[model samples]
Target: MKQRVVPIAVLAGALFAVNVVARLITRFGFDGDDTAQYRITIGMFATIGVILASVAYVRAQKSLPSEWLPSLAAAAIGGMLLTILVGPFLSGGYPFSAGAGNFFSQIWLYGGFAIVGILFGYWIATMLGRDYRSQSLKAFTAAKAGKPRRVVRR
Candidate 1:
Protein backbone atom coordinates (compact mmCIF):
# COMPACT_ATOMS: atom_id res chain seq x y z
CA MET A 1 0.00 0.00 0.00
CA LYS A 2 2.82 2.37 0.79
CA GLN A 3 4.50 1.57 -2.48
CA ARG A 4 1.34 2.23 -4.42
CA VAL A 5 0.68 5.46 -2.63
CA VAL A 6 4.15 6.71 -3.30
CA PRO A 7 3.83 6.21 -7.04
CA ILE A 8 0.42 7.80 -7.14
CA ALA A 9 1.72 10.80 -5.28
CA VAL A 10 4.62 11.05 -7.63
CA LEU A 11 2.33 10.89 -10.62
CA ALA A 12 0.24 13.63 -9.08
CA GLY A 13 3.28 15.74 -8.53
CA ALA A 14 4.39 15.24 -12.08
CA LEU A 15 1.03 16.35 -13.41
CA PHE A 16 1.21 19.33 -11.13
CA ALA A 17 4.61 20.08 -12.52
CA VAL A 18 3.15 20.30 -15.99
CA ASN A 19 0.80 22.97 -14.76
CA VAL A 20 3.66 24.70 -13.06
CA VAL A 21 5.60 24.95 -16.27
CA ALA A 22 2.58 26.19 -18.15
CA ARG A 23 1.76 28.75 -15.52
CA LEU A 24 5.33 29.94 -15.38
CA ILE A 25 5.42 30.31 -19.10
CA THR A 26 2.24 32.30 -19.17
CA ARG A 27 3.29 34.40 -16.23
CA PHE A 28 6.63 35.41 -17.59
CA GLY A 29 6.11 35.05 -21.31
CA PHE A 30 2.68 36.56 -21.69
CA ASP A 31 2.73 38.99 -18.81
CA GLY A 32 -0.26 41.25 -18.16
CA ASP A 33 -2.19 39.94 -21.11
CA ASP A 34 -5.52 38.31 -20.41
CA THR A 35 -5.87 37.04 -23.96
CA ALA A 36 -2.62 35.16 -23.90
CA GLN A 37 -3.26 33.77 -20.47
CA TYR A 38 -6.68 32.50 -21.55
CA ARG A 39 -5.13 30.85 -24.56
CA ILE A 40 -2.56 29.13 -22.39
CA THR A 41 -5.27 27.90 -20.09
CA ILE A 42 -7.24 26.43 -22.98
CA GLY A 43 -4.14 24.77 -24.30
CA MET A 44 -3.43 23.22 -20.93
CA PHE A 45 -6.97 21.91 -20.65
CA ALA A 46 -6.86 20.42 -24.13
CA THR A 47 -3.60 18.70 -23.42
CA ILE A 48 -4.94 17.23 -20.22
CA GLY A 49 -8.11 16.06 -21.98
CA VAL A 50 -6.19 14.14 -24.61
CA ILE A 51 -3.95 12.58 -22.01
CA LEU A 52 -6.84 11.38 -19.85
CA ALA A 53 -8.79 10.05 -22.80
CA SER A 54 -5.81 8.07 -23.94
CA VAL A 55 -5.31 6.60 -20.51
CA ALA A 56 -8.95 5.53 -20.24
CA TYR A 57 -8.98 3.96 -23.67
CA VAL A 58 -5.83 2.07 -22.96
CA ARG A 59 -6.88 0.89 -19.52
CA ALA A 60 -10.46 0.02 -20.33
CA GLN A 61 -9.64 -3.67 -20.22
CA LYS A 62 -8.76 -3.43 -16.58
CA SER A 63 -11.44 -4.03 -13.92
CA LEU A 64 -9.97 -2.13 -11.03
CA PRO A 65 -10.77 1.46 -10.18
CA SER A 66 -8.50 1.16 -7.19
CA GLU A 67 -5.67 1.04 -9.65
CA TRP A 68 -6.59 3.98 -11.84
CA LEU A 69 -8.99 6.29 -10.08
CA PRO A 70 -6.62 7.18 -7.30
CA SER A 71 -3.89 8.02 -9.72
CA LEU A 72 -6.21 10.18 -11.74
CA ALA A 73 -7.66 11.99 -8.77
CA ALA A 74 -4.23 12.62 -7.44
CA ALA A 75 -3.03 13.93 -10.73
CA ALA A 76 -6.01 16.22 -11.02
CA ILE A 77 -5.57 17.66 -7.58
CA GLY A 78 -1.88 18.16 -8.06
CA GLY A 79 -2.43 19.87 -11.34
CA MET A 80 -5.10 22.07 -9.87
CA LEU A 81 -2.91 23.12 -7.00
CA LEU A 82 -0.02 23.96 -9.24
CA THR A 83 -2.23 26.00 -11.50
CA ILE A 84 -4.11 27.82 -8.81
CA LEU A 85 -1.10 28.72 -6.73
CA VAL A 86 1.36 29.35 -9.51
CA GLY A 87 -0.98 30.63 -12.20
CA PRO A 88 -1.47 34.05 -10.78
CA PHE A 89 2.23 34.45 -10.56
CA LEU A 90 2.47 33.46 -14.17
CA SER A 91 -0.14 36.06 -14.96
CA GLY A 92 2.05 38.70 -13.33
CA GLY A 93 0.12 38.95 -10.08
CA TYR A 94 0.27 37.51 -6.61
CA PRO A 95 -1.51 34.23 -5.86
CA PHE A 96 -4.59 36.00 -4.54
CA SER A 97 -4.24 39.38 -6.11
CA ALA A 98 -7.61 39.93 -7.74
CA GLY A 99 -9.76 39.33 -4.72
CA ALA A 100 -12.28 36.55 -5.44
CA GLY A 101 -12.28 36.79 -9.21
CA ASN A 102 -8.95 35.20 -9.94
CA PHE A 103 -9.22 32.70 -7.15
CA PHE A 104 -12.65 31.56 -8.32
CA SER A 105 -11.57 31.51 -11.90
CA GLN A 106 -8.67 29.27 -11.01
CA ILE A 107 -11.01 26.91 -9.21
CA TRP A 108 -13.43 26.93 -12.07
CA LEU A 109 -10.76 26.33 -14.65
CA TYR A 110 -9.14 23.52 -12.71
CA GLY A 111 -12.47 21.85 -11.96
CA GLY A 112 -13.62 22.25 -15.51
CA PHE A 113 -10.47 20.70 -16.86
CA ALA A 114 -10.63 17.71 -14.56
CA ILE A 115 -14.29 17.03 -15.32
CA VAL A 116 -13.78 17.41 -19.02
CA GLY A 117 -10.73 15.21 -18.95
CA ILE A 118 -12.46 12.45 -17.03
CA LEU A 119 -15.47 12.52 -19.31
CA PHE A 120 -13.27 12.27 -22.33
CA GLY A 121 -11.40 9.40 -20.76
CA TYR A 122 -14.59 7.54 -19.92
CA TRP A 123 -16.01 8.14 -23.37
CA ILE A 124 -12.90 6.75 -24.96
CA ALA A 125 -12.99 3.75 -22.71
CA THR A 126 -16.58 3.01 -23.67
CA MET A 127 -15.93 3.43 -27.34
CA LEU A 128 -13.03 1.02 -27.24
CA GLY A 129 -15.20 -1.91 -26.09
CA ARG A 130 -13.16 -2.26 -22.95
CA ASP A 131 -15.76 -0.69 -20.69
CA TYR A 132 -18.79 -2.72 -19.51
CA ARG A 133 -21.10 -1.00 -21.97
CA SER A 134 -18.72 -1.71 -24.81
CA GLN A 135 -18.45 -5.32 -23.77
CA SER A 136 -22.21 -5.68 -23.84
CA LEU A 137 -22.37 -4.13 -27.24
CA LYS A 138 -19.72 -6.47 -28.45
CA ALA A 139 -21.59 -9.47 -27.13
CA PHE A 140 -24.74 -8.28 -28.82
CA THR A 141 -22.96 -7.77 -32.07
CA ALA A 142 -21.36 -11.17 -31.93
CA ALA A 143 -24.63 -12.87 -31.17
CA LYS A 144 -26.35 -11.13 -34.04
CA ALA A 145 -23.65 -11.95 -36.54
CA GLY A 146 -22.54 -15.41 -35.50
CA LYS A 147 -25.43 -17.61 -36.57
CA PRO A 148 -28.47 -18.25 -38.63
CA ARG A 149 -31.85 -19.27 -37.25
CA ARG A 150 -31.69 -22.17 -34.81
CA VAL A 151 -34.45 -24.46 -33.74
CA VAL A 152 -35.56 -24.18 -30.14
CA ARG A 153 -34.88 -27.19 -27.96
CA ARG A 154 -37.07 -27.90 -25.03
Candidate 2:
Protein backbone atom coordinates (compact mmCIF):
# COMPACT_ATOMS: atom_id res chain seq x y z
CA MET A 1 0.00 0.00 0.00
CA LYS A 2 2.79 2.40 0.75
CA GLN A 3 4.44 1.56 -2.52
CA ARG A 4 1.28 2.28 -4.47
CA VAL A 5 0.66 5.50 -2.60
CA VAL A 6 4.13 6.77 -3.36
CA PRO A 7 3.84 6.48 -7.12
CA ILE A 8 0.45 8.17 -7.17
CA ALA A 9 1.77 11.00 -5.05
CA VAL A 10 4.76 11.41 -7.33
CA LEU A 11 2.61 11.58 -10.42
CA ALA A 12 0.34 14.14 -8.81
CA GLY A 13 3.31 16.22 -7.78
CA ALA A 14 4.67 16.04 -11.29
CA LEU A 15 1.42 17.33 -12.71
CA PHE A 16 1.35 20.19 -10.25
CA ALA A 17 4.92 21.00 -11.09
CA VAL A 18 4.00 21.35 -14.72
CA ASN A 19 1.19 23.71 -13.78
CA VAL A 20 3.53 25.75 -11.63
CA VAL A 21 6.06 26.09 -14.38
CA ALA A 22 3.41 27.30 -16.75
CA ARG A 23 2.06 29.78 -14.25
CA LEU A 24 5.50 31.12 -13.52
CA ILE A 25 6.25 31.51 -17.17
CA THR A 26 2.97 33.30 -17.74
CA ARG A 27 3.36 35.57 -14.77
CA PHE A 28 6.92 36.65 -15.39
CA GLY A 29 7.88 36.10 -18.99
CA PHE A 30 4.62 36.50 -20.76
CA ASP A 31 2.93 39.08 -18.61
CA GLY A 32 0.50 41.32 -20.54
CA ASP A 33 0.79 39.10 -23.57
CA ASP A 34 -2.42 37.20 -24.13
CA THR A 35 -1.09 35.41 -27.17
CA ALA A 36 1.94 34.18 -25.36
CA GLN A 37 -0.14 33.12 -22.39
CA TYR A 38 -2.50 31.19 -24.58
CA ARG A 39 0.35 29.45 -26.26
CA ILE A 40 1.89 28.57 -22.94
CA THR A 41 -1.39 27.15 -21.70
CA ILE A 42 -1.72 24.95 -24.75
CA GLY A 43 1.83 23.78 -24.46
CA MET A 44 1.37 23.01 -20.78
CA PHE A 45 -1.77 20.98 -21.41
CA ALA A 46 -0.07 19.06 -24.15
CA THR A 47 2.74 18.23 -21.80
CA ILE A 48 0.23 17.04 -19.25
CA GLY A 49 -1.41 14.85 -21.85
CA VAL A 50 1.88 13.29 -22.81
CA ILE A 51 2.77 12.66 -19.20
CA LEU A 52 -0.49 10.84 -18.52
CA ALA A 53 -0.35 8.97 -21.81
CA SER A 54 3.12 7.72 -21.02
CA VAL A 55 2.04 6.55 -17.59
CA ALA A 56 -0.99 4.79 -19.06
CA TYR A 57 0.98 3.08 -21.77
CA VAL A 58 3.58 1.84 -19.34
CA ARG A 59 1.05 0.67 -16.73
CA ALA A 60 -1.12 -1.12 -19.27
CA GLN A 61 1.82 -3.33 -20.15
CA LYS A 62 2.34 -4.45 -16.55
CA SER A 63 -1.11 -4.94 -15.02
CA LEU A 64 -4.79 -5.20 -15.70
CA PRO A 65 -6.55 -1.86 -16.15
CA SER A 66 -8.80 -2.60 -13.18
CA GLU A 67 -5.78 -2.92 -10.98
CA TRP A 68 -3.88 0.17 -12.08
CA LEU A 69 -6.43 2.59 -13.44
CA PRO A 70 -7.68 3.82 -10.09
CA SER A 71 -4.21 4.96 -9.20
CA LEU A 72 -3.99 6.95 -12.40
CA ALA A 73 -7.45 8.39 -11.88
CA ALA A 74 -6.62 9.45 -8.36
CA ALA A 75 -3.43 11.08 -9.49
CA ALA A 76 -5.20 13.04 -12.17
CA ILE A 77 -7.90 14.26 -9.81
CA GLY A 78 -5.35 15.21 -7.20
CA GLY A 79 -3.32 17.11 -9.72
CA MET A 80 -6.34 18.88 -11.12
CA LEU A 81 -7.48 20.08 -7.72
CA LEU A 82 -4.06 21.34 -6.82
CA THR A 83 -3.54 23.04 -10.13
CA ILE A 84 -6.92 24.73 -10.08
CA LEU A 85 -7.13 25.83 -6.48
CA VAL A 86 -3.59 26.42 -5.31
CA GLY A 87 -1.98 27.30 -8.60
CA PRO A 88 -3.39 30.80 -8.92
CA PHE A 89 -1.92 31.86 -5.64
CA LEU A 90 1.53 31.16 -6.94
CA SER A 91 0.90 33.87 -9.54
CA GLY A 92 -0.56 36.33 -7.04
CA GLY A 93 -4.09 35.72 -8.20
CA TYR A 94 -7.23 33.96 -7.12
CA PRO A 95 -8.42 30.76 -8.75
CA PHE A 96 -11.38 32.50 -10.30
CA SER A 97 -9.80 35.91 -10.69
CA ALA A 98 -9.49 35.18 -14.33
CA GLY A 99 -13.30 35.18 -14.40
CA ALA A 100 -15.88 32.43 -14.33
CA GLY A 101 -15.51 31.62 -18.01
CA ASN A 102 -11.81 31.12 -17.75
CA PHE A 103 -12.11 29.07 -14.58
CA PHE A 104 -14.62 26.71 -16.16
CA SER A 105 -12.67 26.53 -19.37
CA GLN A 106 -9.62 25.43 -17.49
CA ILE A 107 -11.62 22.60 -15.95
CA TRP A 108 -12.93 21.57 -19.34
CA LEU A 109 -9.47 21.61 -20.80
CA TYR A 110 -7.99 19.59 -17.97
CA GLY A 111 -10.63 16.88 -18.20
CA GLY A 112 -10.52 16.79 -21.97
CA PHE A 113 -6.76 16.49 -22.11
CA ALA A 114 -6.64 13.83 -19.42
CA ILE A 115 -9.27 11.63 -21.09
CA VAL A 116 -7.70 11.96 -24.51
CA GLY A 117 -4.32 11.09 -23.11
CA ILE A 118 -5.60 7.97 -21.38
CA LEU A 119 -7.49 6.83 -24.43
CA PHE A 120 -4.53 7.39 -26.68
CA GLY A 121 -2.26 5.44 -24.38
CA TYR A 122 -4.68 2.53 -24.00
CA TRP A 123 -5.32 2.49 -27.73
CA ILE A 124 -1.67 2.19 -28.51
CA ALA A 125 -1.25 -0.58 -25.97
CA THR A 126 -4.17 -2.48 -27.46
CA MET A 127 -2.88 -2.04 -30.99
CA LEU A 128 0.52 -3.39 -30.00
CA GLY A 129 -1.08 -6.37 -28.21
CA ARG A 130 0.94 -5.39 -25.17
CA ASP A 131 -1.86 -4.36 -22.86
CA TYR A 132 -2.57 -6.64 -19.93
CA ARG A 133 -5.80 -7.98 -21.36
CA SER A 134 -4.22 -8.79 -24.68
CA GLN A 135 -1.22 -10.40 -23.08
CA SER A 136 -3.42 -12.37 -20.74
CA LEU A 137 -5.51 -13.64 -23.63
CA LYS A 138 -2.42 -14.73 -25.48
CA ALA A 139 -1.08 -16.54 -22.45
CA PHE A 140 -4.39 -18.23 -21.90
CA THR A 141 -4.55 -19.54 -25.42
CA ALA A 142 -0.99 -20.75 -25.30
CA ALA A 143 -1.52 -22.65 -22.06
CA LYS A 144 -4.77 -24.22 -23.22
CA ALA A 145 -3.17 -25.57 -26.36
CA GLY A 146 -1.49 -28.47 -24.55
CA LYS A 147 -4.55 -29.45 -22.51
CA PRO A 148 -7.52 -31.52 -23.54
CA ARG A 149 -10.93 -30.13 -22.68
CA ARG A 150 -13.24 -32.21 -20.56
CA VAL A 151 -16.63 -32.95 -22.04
CA VAL A 152 -19.53 -31.17 -20.38
CA ARG A 153 -22.15 -33.35 -18.73
CA ARG A 154 -25.71 -32.70 -19.85
All candidates' TM-scores? 0.71, 0.90
lDDT of each: 0.71, 0.93
Model 1, CA-based lDDT: 0.71
Q: Which residue pairs clash within candidate 2?
A: none
The TM-score measured for candidate 1 stands at: 0.71
Q: Judged by TM-score, which candidate is best?
A: 2
99: Cα error in model 2, Å:
1.1
Worst 10 residues of 2 by lDDT: 110-119
> Candidate 1's residue-wise lDDT over 25-126, tens digit each?
887788788999789877876776666666655555564545676677777777677767865665567778878886887788767877777777777676
Residue pairs whose backbone atoms clash in candidate 1: 27-90
Q: Show model 2 residue runs off by greater than 4 Å.
A: 146-154
